[model samples]
Target: MRELLTALLSQDPTIEVVGSATDPYQARQMIKQLLPDVITLDIEMPRMDGLSFLEKIMTLRPMPVVMVSSLTQQGAEATLNALELGAVDFFPKPKLDMKRGIEKRADELIHKIKTAAQAKVKTLEREQDTPLALNPLSNIKFSTTEKIIAIGASTGGVEALRVVIKNLPANSPAVLVTQHMPEKFTKTFAERLNKISAVSISEAKHGERVLPGHVYIAPGGKHLKLHRSGANYLCQLTDEEAVSGHKPSVDVLFRSTSEAAGKNAIGVILTGMGKDGAAGMLELREVGAKTFGQDEASCVVYGMPKAAYDIGAVEHQVSLNKITEAMLNACGAAKDRHIRV
Candidate 1:
């Protein structure tokens, strides 16, 4: 697997694989000597595991690290944990015909590596206490007739969304999310969010009703849109060609929501790379939908939100910790309940 990755990365003109080691001792020696800018690590190893090593690296010599792991249940959980422990990003190691899968996903692999190289790695600290069950409110009111939330993220979105979604109250607006992720990882990512968040979360399905307190994530390789059906909105999934270099693009979702939900929608462009959602966010803003962007101080990449902010697409640029409350306020939720940033 390491050799395959090395060969793939070596083909990219902008990337060079500095060194490879089969064990932790050799890896430590190479890190001290070569002092590479980025590291691609596998979760499973013969000696010290990737998670343990990642914790050590963050504490001692914090730098950008992308995890390469299998697309299994255990792998998903461990990768999520690794993100909490300061890993920049992750890509699933394909299980089927290795050469064919690697070749097929070569562009995505190279893109992630480049994004990871530019990513800012922060020392993360996780709360060890058990999560308390949240009560779903029965009397929350929306300023508009219908309330909908659209979110788009990439790069550091795995951990960023975890913070934003987990902080939301149970009876918030119906959410539509576009996260640049692979097909196999979207389900796992949604499932992980469901376990941690107060509201239910799942991969979006065609014609599914958009209900309050539920979050829908766009499936990989497909575009997810919002369409009004009578008084309620419904999810519409399509196999449209990639927009802004991604299939389930933030631009597509924001534009669809802007057209379908109008001012009733809230468009949020979170931490990510590139300008996928910037133009769409401007459309949403023009149509009177409140829009927010993740502030630069809290962003992992700051590229996407900065682009949107530059075009006046974002109305309020808030920290990741304050975005949930800001969304609630936009939806007419009480202001006194705001969580500190």
Candidate 2:
């Protein structure tokens, strides 16, 4: 398995196969020696379970970790927990059937590893404790919105948002996104979104106003909140204390929207790990706002949305294929509300 994976990564110039191990004991020693930039882990290592060893690594010498696993339901749940414990993400391993499915999945595996390798490593250090710096918000400026849409996500959020946003109309409502990304990546993510979707998307500048036809991503290392002044909404980027174990926490964004936009805001929680946005989505619902969560069948990791659903945070559950239509329906300018939300 290690040799095959090594050859696979070597085939792609963007990926460098640094080290590989099938057992936790060998993996631990390899990590100590190679200190590779990114580590790919299998859930069922021979010497010890992957999760137990992963806990040790996280509590000891934290670094970027990605879990490679089967796509089974059990594997999915385990992989999601690993993310909550600070593994950056997970990619479903290629199926074992010799004549089936593997060819179609190899590119996805390669892409995920490349993305993980490029993930900001330093952010893992005290990442859960990092606060939102309020400095950027001082004396900032913003554009007002007729109605603001607040969205929060993590883990597989990038691709999920891509699927949903790609289907939205140019006249869609103003959007504020809080995806749990690192500092440099949010800009890249926003730029990527901007290119793939008709709506303008950019990294949030402190005090930037919420405007229809544009989307703002909360800076990865900061916290974003909505503040209202005379019927307009402003994005206030800050370094205040971490909320729900994430710097740009989804809960913080949702709660602030509940406070600032009230009934005019639509809160959506997409794919991710942990219980971060569960409470906030409910708060959005309580204020006569609409709340939506990504359904389990379509999630890369169903942790966040499931947490919200279990606690009554979501008023609607939609699959990846239908979420953008749902968002459009919620926005009221679209021709239909027939889509799920």
Candidate 3:
């Protein structure tokens, strides 16, 4: 696996394979000697597990590191923990015909590694418990029509989405999320959010009614779009080919929101590696949906939002913490609360 990754990455003109290590001790020695810009770490390493080593690195060196793990329940949980412990991103270790699998996903691997290299990593502290439920909005009046919130994220989304979604009020609009993630990981991500957020969150199922105070995460390997069904909007999932190089694409969700909900939709583009949602966000703006982007300083990787901002798709460029309030304001639910923008 190590040899394959080295060979694959070395093929990229912009990337170079530095020293490779067989163990944590060797890795530490190589890090000191080579001082490489980015590190691709395996979750199951000899001498020390990746999570423990990752925590130590974040505490001491605080550099960009990406996790390479299997795609399973345990792997998903450990990857999430690694993110919280300061991993910039994670890539699933190839399964079945190792060399071919690696070759097939070589572009994705290279992209993630490059993105990780550019990510601004802050020291991660254990998160404090947040209130599980919010006070019901008293002063806000809901229109007869439903308001929809469309949120897109990638690289640092696990933590960034946590900050934004957990801050939403109990009466917030129905949210449709397209976070770049793998199949099983999306379910686990939604479950994690449901525990910490005021609103209910689940992986979206085809033909399900999009309800208020709930978030629908686009299932991995599928496209999540919205359809108007009488008085309610419905979730529609498709196995269309990858859009913007993503299956559960942010562009697909935002485009559907613009067409279906129009002015009633709120589009948010958060931290990510590339410009997947930028064009779709512009379409949303053209259709009168309010759009917001996370500012560069607050993002782990500022690529996506910066693209949106540059293209005029984003109306407001706010910090990560202020995104929920901005969405609530767009939904007309942020009247009395003092929200910092």
Q: For candidate 1, write residues 137-244 as lDDT tens digits.
A: 333555543789999998889888887788666677899999987786788889988987778999999999999889999998899999998887999999989999
**How do these models rank on lDDT, best leading?**
3, 1, 2
Ten residues in a row with the worst lDDT in model 1? 129-138
Candidate 2, residues 1-341, lDDT tens digits: the string is 67766766687886777777768888888888888877888888776888887778878887777887775656755665566456767666645772245445577567666656544332223322112232211222223236678888887776567666654555668889998865655776677667656668899998777787788999878998988878667889989888998899999999999999888888899987778999999999999898889888877667889899999989999987777666655655423236677
What candidate 3 gets wrong by more than 4 Å, as runs, is 133-145, 334-341
TM-score of each: 0.91, 0.60, 0.93
Model 2 residue 199 CA deviation (Å) reads 0.8
Candidate 1 stretches greater than 4 Å from native: 128-145, 334-341
Q: Highest lDDT: which candidate?
A: 3
lDDT for model 2 comes to 0.74
Model 1 residue 254 lDDT score: 98
**Residue 176, model 2: Cα distance from true site in angstroms:** 0.5
Q: How high is the CA lDDT of each candidate model?
A: 0.87, 0.74, 0.88
On a 0 to 100 scale, what is the lDDT of residue 198 in model 2?
Answer: 62
lDDT of 3 by residue, 1-341 (tens): 89988998998999988789998889998999999999989999889998989988888888999899888888898998888788999989756677887789999899888889899998767777565543333235455337899999999988899888876655667999999999899999899888877778999999999988899999889999989988889999999899998898999999999999999999999999889999999999999999999999999999999999999999999998777777777786534456799
Among the numbered candidates, top TM-score falls to 3
| Residue 66's lDDT in candidate 2 | 80
